[model samples]
Target: MTPPEHGILGRVAGAVTGKVVDAVPVEEILEHVDLDAVLDQVDVNHLLDRIDVNRFLDRVDLDRLLARADVNALLAGVDLEDLVQRAGIPDVVASTTGDLLGRTLDVARRQVVGLDAVVTGLVDRLLRRRGPAPLGPVLLVGER
Candidate 1:
């Protein structure tokens, strides 16, 4: 039978083999490899299709993931004014402003009506009209 491998000789042989293997650089091995052929063999679409999206999402810690993200940096990359304009925010603001102005004008008109009564009373008092003074109609200053 052939000599049985063990002890000091076996250990030395193993060490020498390991050192020789280690001496062979990975870059030298990669240089000999056909990278395009290796890439062609990989089915990326098939691998992705095998992934369960819901299960993957369930495994994800969304809040923790979001906490790690730089929100201010992300926002800095975005044009907020442009985004608001695209979302029709300006139109909404304009419509809301118009509604508010219309309501304010209506309120002013009501207040002016009360002022008309007060001014008419003052005018009647100046004219020295006796008995119950009639609250006259609103007279526009520039109207015919």
Candidate 2:
């Protein structure tokens, strides 16, 4: 992944960290350089403008669909317990269950990254296609 690709991950990591770091010195670091602020400053829509949607979807990880014993058993027409025993709680195929789980999670993460890229592309396309629109309505008025 390139620097721009990291933007999506950075935004997610920052938001997750921010919730727990509000009172820490990290706030000072954020004041100096905030991921969300940086994301806002950039036109993410611009980055997504050129991607092919079909190709993007093809890159998504589908292994997670069978990562669960129940799901795998159902798909393969076997009993869940039998499947579990065959692929034990601590083993999947030949590797440790934890290793299999980790790989599955890695695939899921990559899928998420692919999805984010597609979304960013779609946003860029829409922004470019629509040009600019009037910001006229303030539906819910809030007190300052």
Q: Model 1 over residues 59-107: C-alpha lDDT tens digits?
A: 9999999999998998998999999999999999999999999999999
Which consecutive 10 residues in model 1 have the weakest lDDT in total? 135-144
lDDT of 2 at 64: 70
lDDT of 2 by residue, 24-121 (tens): 68667668776887888887788788778889879876687546448555668657688788767645555776688999999999999789777767
| Cα lDDT, model 1, residue 28 | 84
- Which candidate gets the maximum lDDT versus the true structure? 1
Cα RMSD to native, each candidate? 9.5, 42.8
Residue runs of model 1 more than 4 Å from their true location after superposition: 1-44, 118-144
Task: List the lowest-lDDT window of 10 residues for candidate 2.
Answer: 129-138
